[model samples]
Target: MAERDGGLLLFLTGAGISAESGIPTFRGPEGYWRVGSVNYRPQELATFQAFSRMPDVVWGWYLYRRGVCRHASPNAAHLAIVRAEERLGDRFHLVTQNVDGLHLRAGSSLARTYAIHGMIDFFRCARECTAETYPIPDALPLDWAKDRLPTPEERARLRCPRCGADGRPHVLFFDEYYDEPRFHCESAQRKALEASALVVVGTTGLTNLPMRIGAIAAQRRIPVHVVDLEPNPFVEFAEVTGGEFLRGPAGSLVPELVERLVG
Candidate 1:
């Protein structure tokens, strides 16, 4: 699918890549939200159903998350990916499940990085009045306090830039399915199949599309590399396919791996 002389090197990253940057992986206590006396898990709170029922609660939760991501800086792994992009040029592709925008913040080209989970820095019309996403209003504080609802003025600013309708996070809600234009799901899958090498970093391969990509690549005997602090499905796949498994923190391992790849 790519015309690079050296073939494509595709990297699939997940929340684990941002953990070292001080962002919660959203698998533990940090993923829970309390509205009134009811507690909702990330899966429950991150759905359209929940948002439609209580838009204020949902916006507050997401705004708090955005604040967390905004304050956290990119770690070594993110920077290494940027360096990899610089050296490999068109031969490199980044498919990330993270919405923190750290890869782009670390200097990775936005054109080459496909954020399949969507970004936290932007919002789109909840009514789908427009397909374009607009930046979250600068007037809305990035340090949005937890459990605090938007003020009337802040709420007004959250309206769609084009139609004055309610705005939704640019993220893919749990209840929503992925599509080509919004999430780049199809493009990432195509790149996975075409990649000369598939590097699985920090992700457990629990999500459907990413799992499919790894399974197909392994089934085709592609060189699969797994880098993580512990064993997981990707590690098993790599070992079964006679691929490399580098066990350690992504912060250190990813940089070393990128250097070797670009050497």
Candidate 2:
């Protein structure tokens, strides 16, 4: 699967890919971070209502995730994708489920990269209210410790600067709908549909309307490969499962894939 290049290599990734960096998957080691059970479901922490009604809780979750992502370095798998992108050039699209800007931070210049989950580094005007909101690219509050404790000021201003509604993490909640242009962003997917090769990594394959996109590639008989820890529903759309669907983590498997493509 890695050997094929010079065509579209759409790399779709998920939270599992980031787990190698010691960052917790929404359901971390003990499972959920909430009380009672360690297995925590994102629920309120990642919802439109939570973002709108409970900005503090939602943003607090973002704060915790932000801190983790800020300090977390991209793993070998991420770098491998970058290398593969360099090898494939414009032929590759690294679409990710994660909102964290890790791939961008990893020096991935591949412009086709898409963030289905939105971004944490940049905040928007809550409800698309204004054209501009404060873009905090590099850092966070000066006093993260106090901020974590839910200081009063932090709670008040967390409101969205865009709509004057409450501000929440820029991440896409399950109920939220993407404006199409920003989420899918461009004609990249259409181009990839016409691609000679397609690649999916680490995703659970439960995202948006894939039936149409999947059919596009199937109609063309484009070679598709799936890589993950377990069998993904998208695997059926693939011609082959080149890497373990549920075995090696992305950090371990991605480099091998890069080397294959680059070879």
Candidate 3:
């Protein structure tokens, strides 16, 4: 219900935004993690079955990823989103596919920022006894390259405080279905439905939710500006929605777009 010129603005981001901060994309070659002699792709390691089979292995992978994210700082693209939020205030809503938490770190409010992929810095009880998500301590090592499997001591430390059950990373695994309470899927859908303008940054629309967002905007005759390093499937959708496709790195293009739009 928040209005900007005549409509709301919804900004959707993906791994491309965080990649500017030197964070690797999940489907990229860098996303492959080796455990012992077996190499697991992100899709394989990031699943409920993987966690059920080897909780330590899964937790270790997440811990390593968390370390990487913690080491990387928010880039200009993230800061631009914060500025856009400031200008648009209640009219701006962010729906991000990245779990790196860069958007929140860049000062976007949690109330307006929907992390549809959940967050890497949070942990929940594996049993889902409660909906509580506890923040992981900052004191944990940021360099976990040596050990891909958590030590017995580390496993004990990762146990859920309330239920004495194993703690799992608060991320939407590949096999997990999206839900409102956990992943803000419903909220994102509602925002897209009501959005006056949709600004897509660093995403290729590979996932269902993002594609649906584009389709909704196109159907509603809302402008859908897309920014990415290379041409993507979204460019066609942008043209269909009467928006331009700005081909460039998000770090450079997003700030320029924000300045032009908000200035």
Candidate 4:
């Protein structure tokens, strides 16, 4: 079928897309927190409450993740999304659940791509003293082993410049709520409502905002195609929305899908 005439085509991505780029899926067994007997699950460590209780530990964990993101290159799936954006221009929008910044690294424009989960490379004031979220300096160590907590000096470096408060990763923690200015939940929904079609890649429909997007598309009669490695709720979601389900890794499927759409 030809691409939809005028409305936007939204591409929503999740952790599974980044996993193809050698980044470990944070929800998998590898994501277990094992820092010196303080065994926390991925969900536990990814909360604001956890960060409030142990900022050093939280910083260390994110530092390791940042290192992993830094070392990894954008995969074919990411590059394909960028190419689609180039072809579609204003008709293309990317709403990603990943914080790895892979989409941006792959040349997706920041103006058009909404990182609803926040980014690993940026830090915001814990006190919210300023609306600014600053990029972590490259001079800082990204490869710090997770076995030890960040040193006092290293922790000090993470402090907010505008205030004496600690700098927290600019990510939406499990305990946090999504807002328009920060995580762009409202904007994503708006885009979903306006979209003629949606392409969901590498997500399992586990998160609220993503599910909301799918529901909006389904309710509006917009086609919702899904790309995943295994059968998940999204496959059923696709069926319900009168869309196709392509069962395979996004790295292979997304590029081919983009070619078909744009050609």
Per-candidate clashes come to 0, 15, 0, 0
Across residues 152-217, which tens digit of lDDT does each residue of candidate 4 receive?
A: 887788889998798999999989998887788899999998888899999888889999999888
By descending TM-score, how would the candidates be arranged?
A: 4, 3, 1, 2
Candidate 1's displacement at residue 166, Å, is: 0.7
Clashes of 3: 0
Tell me which residue pairs clash in candidate 3: none
Candidate 4 residues lying further than 4 Å off, grouped into runs, are 1-4
**Model 2 residue 137 lDDT?**
37
- 44 Cα displacement, candidate 1 (Å): 2.3
Stretches off by above 4 angstroms in model 3 are 1-6
Instruction: Please give the RMSD to the true structure for each candidate, in Å.
Output: 2.2, 4.1, 1.9, 1.6
Query: Stretches of candidate 2 above 4 Å error?
Result: 1-5, 28-41, 130-134, 137-139, 142-152, 155-166, 185-188, 209-215, 240-247
Which tens-of-lDDT digit does each residue in 32-125 have in candidate 1?
A: 7777787778877788998889888888888889999999999999999898888888889999999998999999998999989899998889
Compute the lDDT of residue 204 as modeled in candidate 3.
81
Candidate 1: how large is its RMSD? 2.2
lDDT for each candidate structure: 0.86, 0.63, 0.86, 0.87
Ranking by lDDT: 4, 3, 1, 2
